[model samples]
Target: MDPKETYSPLNCPKPVAEGIWIFDGLMIRMDLGPFKIPFPTRMTVVRLGDGTLWIHSPIAPDEDLFSAVDALGSVRHVIAPNSIHYWYMADWLERYPGARSYAVPDLATTAKRPFRIDHPLMDGARFAWESEIDWILVPGTKVSEAVFHVPSARTVILVDLIENFEAAKLSSPLMRFMLKLVGGLDPNGMAPLDLRMTFRPKRKQVRERLQRVVDWQPEKVIMAHGRIYDRDGAQELRRAFRWAI
Candidate 1:
């Protein structure tokens, strides 16, 4: 799907599953001091049994987006699934002051900006929607990304752990070159080569964690970047992590 066409700040929330909705936001130009490039990003919203919402990897919220979310349910939890994804936490917090914010433990020390983390996400931690949702921390990387599973929808939610960029969608040659170098370009793009290297000595642990996800047999996989895997998700996941496993 073309992110520009599908996700807009002015567009309404798109339903991905029964209780799950997704919002496509503007492409983020990742700036690393000397290096800068744009990458598409997305956010997910999950409504729990109590009618509370869980905002994951939130995008920049505007008045319209906020109003749309409010119509669904009260925002109860804002989750920064990983370190890099926490930049928008402050924005969400300001909008939903009553909502609790949660982030991976590493973000508390690694993140440069200030944000309140009501709770640190732990391995195998359970939530109010435990019966329908499950989560796991993909260990061994500099950033331990938390992957969530919605059993009811047979969907798996990911942050930066896996990416699938389409070359045509990249507007800049530099961005395309960078994505190619990191193996982010589809159709077989998996974890970046550098990220895979970070798992050295702990590849076994990382592989084990991925195995659990594979066993879930997801029918769809939603990621922060690239196209969402709606068919053969389980096979695609295994292929994406082949280097690590």
Candidate 2:
């Protein structure tokens, strides 16, 4: 269905469902120490019943983007689903003065932060988002990605539990090769090899979480990086996690 079209013109919010939107941001490179890999940045924005907005994994917000989001609703809650995705909370925190910040329990312990987490709980809900979104935390990974489902939209929001990098979009041969080597390519993308191995020890836990997502039966799966799944989401969930669960 040409999923890349869903994330075009990067840096703008594209509607994914009724109250949900996915913002495609810039291409950022991450250093793996041995080498750097290019990652397409993305984030999700959901408007609450109170007309306030909840931003999942904040990207670098520009003035135009800020104005567009303001038109949608006020940014009241900013969340970092995992340690790797928490880097930009400082920006959203400063932009939305009273917005509460959320993240994994171990985030502030290691990942350097210029900000503080008002809620360090990713499993429980102390806010209104719970009524709309259901989430399961994937254990045994460095990222500790929290996968969420928006029942109203029949959609699942994922940060990095599965990555489907398109070969055509990847410019570097080495990067393409690395992704292919780690089974990060499209049509078969799931957790990378390293994450699969980490999850091996906790396959039962990962299986339980994966089963919950499949049970949601989403119409689409939105990821922070790589092409998204817009159909057969339940079947895709099983295929994607076959390595772990």
Candidate 3:
């Protein structure tokens, strides 16, 4: 999927899954405004096999995006996986008042300021989403508390663990320097330079967490920061965080 075509001039197209669909975002460069970014952000819409839709991550502030999401099946839940991502949850929840909000425990309390969070994610816990998506908690990230595994695509959806960027065009000195330092412009960007030190103490935990991830033997890794890994997923994950290997 070419970023420019898939999400460029327009917002991410709706992706229909086993009852789920994805409404990606407008790519925004730090220098370029939201509409002018050379890249885009993708939001996930998980419709459980039961027809209950779970909206993950935040959506753009545009009215069209909001209207599009409303057109989907009944939204039973809204998730702000981590602390830093709840900014858009308020609008979404307001629009769909019937949908209950859930967040990581730490974020749940704080997220209350904007939305009514009804559930807190627990580590090692498993939740039966749709027949197609089985979610598990990956408790080491500072913001997000879990990652999702989609067995059908041999895909593991990680909100902040690994990110695959198209380095060719994003290789500009500014982008490179920034990515090499603060990490990417989004949550799943490769380990930020700051997180490297923070994650040092949790190295073993992170490794063990990944071990469980490997148990899934995922083929595609979907990260929120950059592009998705379609092949050699395991090796690419190891390379994403050098310490994990």
Candidate 4:
């Protein structure tokens, strides 16, 4: 019933890089085969060169949260980086009608509700962020995720590709164990066991894509569902994908 138990001090925007911030929001449970798992929600906002926001995996929004976000800049581009993470896109667009939406193409069929995608999350589209942000699609999953590298900030933003749930944040040993069973335990987190399996058939493609990310030499890595890897990011990226790479 309490979101703070999963992600505390909610509805606040915390800075990640000079032009980037992360907002923590509601708690949610996702079904992983037969198990229902609890996870805290996080979203990233990048103030592009035009001063409009580039949101990735938007969290549930409240008026207050919207106002705080508006102060950062006009909400211009809302993104559903992957299929499963598109849940709250509708809530966001309803408030910022001027904001254009973009999502993974696979979402057209996977989404339970109709999601408006103004563009595909593709690179070389001449997006405003091109000078600062480079992107690529991490293939080999039903819920294809788009990963972004902000060279100016040395940050890489991700949704669902990795989950590093900190042990101290969980209230129960059982919950921690269950989370670990899904490969979400901190310091060793990668995508959940089930998600990684999806890459088995295309591990080479996944590995090649991940290696390109590792070469970015990121200094900070941000995740939507767990702790942020704030240092040694490129190394962390390599370690997390070690199993398949």
Candidate 5:
């Protein structure tokens, strides 16, 4: 059976802000040596002022997803916000051949598969949407993740930096146990414990960067995994990073 035939839209992209739409992508299962379970993922679509779409963390592309995106504008930029988020980048590139692909710095070396990277995303790098979107590199982690802030919407887009997994979403007992041990279960999910440990030596630097995020005064916070904070985003962000900060 063809895998594409099995592809079905999980959550169609819906507007969260004026120019931003988010959708829950298909669940991805991971084998963490001793455990295996399907985990939900998401994709964010931002329609720039110029009517071009900026895709963040590309997910499985299907007719429904493409139709929704096409109704907005041409897909012009594909962004891999972190090294681990490059899974579906090649597919997006194939769909939007003209779109410029940007990956977080050092992704070429860390990515599990090959994809065309037009340029490396750097802190404060300027783009066509620079006036509206600002990006910063979250420091002190094994994976380089870039956090983006859209001034127009007063929103922040995060990848793996902060994950909020609900208990009900865990299908396996082992998965629940592991998530509980790492503090990834519902109600208080923040960054994973192991990922936070990576910030030990660079905690200070990471805090400074997070402080800048706080300074943005974001109203909405979107994470690749888990529920989005539609209100008090800044406060939630501070709480999420309290350990590292």
Candidate 6:
């Protein structure tokens, strides 16, 4: 067994949009039911103008996953947005020997693998090259923090903090209903129906983060699960945690 191989089935479906291709499934979530997600996974590939490439949220391990990445040209960096999203990084690092992997602030200590997390993202951190991608650390609710927004593409990528399962291709009725019950249909698709209420005391802080997101005026919003939000993303997010925002 490859010590770095944390994934079971390996590989996931391939979905491409704009200049990014999403690779889904990299872990096994037995709790998700007969969903056969192989692993609930999603990955993003961005090709910048200078010919450098960036892939975010590497999911599960599979022979095919690496081959798929190899097909996309040389990958320069792999970003593990949060601790929960680091499961497959070891395998990805092993596969792309020369590629650099970066971990969000709180994830590196527990990652258990050796790699330099070249970038550390704090709340409201903005990175700009020819295009601009902002990382807003939404703290307090969960121990996790997400790197949000890619201005050049008008896209927002949230890890566990916000999920949109619409990309999961759920054929099971139970899965769909479960998703709806948890507000998965919403733009942010926050976990626990009561997440807003869980952090009721910090509602003010949450609202401040939301306000910053609203200021960005993103055109496209993508979560780990559910459908992508194309229009009125700010309002959708506000409505998701109505109590908090």
Residues 1-245, candidate 4, lDDT per residue (tens digit)?
Answer: 55445666777789988899999888887775666567889999999887888888899889889999989999998989887889889989898888899888788777997777888765445565667788888776565788999998999999878899888777667778887877978988888887888777888888888889889999999998778998999999999888777
In terms of lDDT, the best-performing candidate is: 4
Q: What tens digits encode model 5's per-residue C-alpha lDDT throughout 210-239?
A: 889888999999988777788888888888
Model 6, 1-245: lDDT tens per residue? Answer: 22122222335434444666566554355354445432255677776666666778876656777777777778887888766667677778878878876667776565666556666666444443325456666655445556567677777676655655552355556766776776554334655454434445666776777667767776666555445566666665555545455
Which lDDT values do the candidates have, in the order given? Answer: 0.82, 0.81, 0.61, 0.84, 0.81, 0.61
TM-score against truth, every candidate: 0.91, 0.92, 0.76, 0.94, 0.91, 0.73
- Model 5: clashing residue pairs? none
**What RMSD does each model have against the real structure?**
2.5, 3.1, 4.9, 1.7, 3.4, 5.8
lDDT of 1 by residue, 1-245 (tens): 34542335433588888899888776677663367656677899999888999899998778888998899899999999986888889999998899998889888888888799888888656666668678888766586788899988898998877888777787667777877887878887787776677777687888899889888999889998887888788998888878876
Q: On a 0 to 100 scale, what is the lDDT of residue 145 in model 1? A: 80
The reply for model 2, stretches above 4 Å from the true place, is 1-7, 122-125
Q: Which parts of model 1 have CA positions greater than 4 angstroms off?
A: 1-11, 31-35
Estimate the lDDT of model 1. Answer: 0.82
TM-score for candidate 2: 0.92
> What's the lDDT for residue 187 in model 6?
36
Top candidate, metric TM-score: 4
lDDT score of residue 158 within candidate 2: 83
Query: How would you encode candidate 3's per-residue C-alpha lDDT over 85-175 as one tens digit per residue?
Result: 5767788788888888777777755554566777666765445564676666544545544667777666666665654455554635566
Model 1 — which ten-residue stretch has the worst lDDT? Answer: 2-11
Error of 2 at 107 (Å): 0.3
Model 3 lDDT, residue 40, Cα:
49
Root-mean-square deviation of Cα positions for candidate 6 versus the true structure, in angstroms: 5.8
| TM-score, structure 1 vs. true | 0.91
Of the candidates numbered 3 and 5, which has the greater lDDT value? Answer: 5
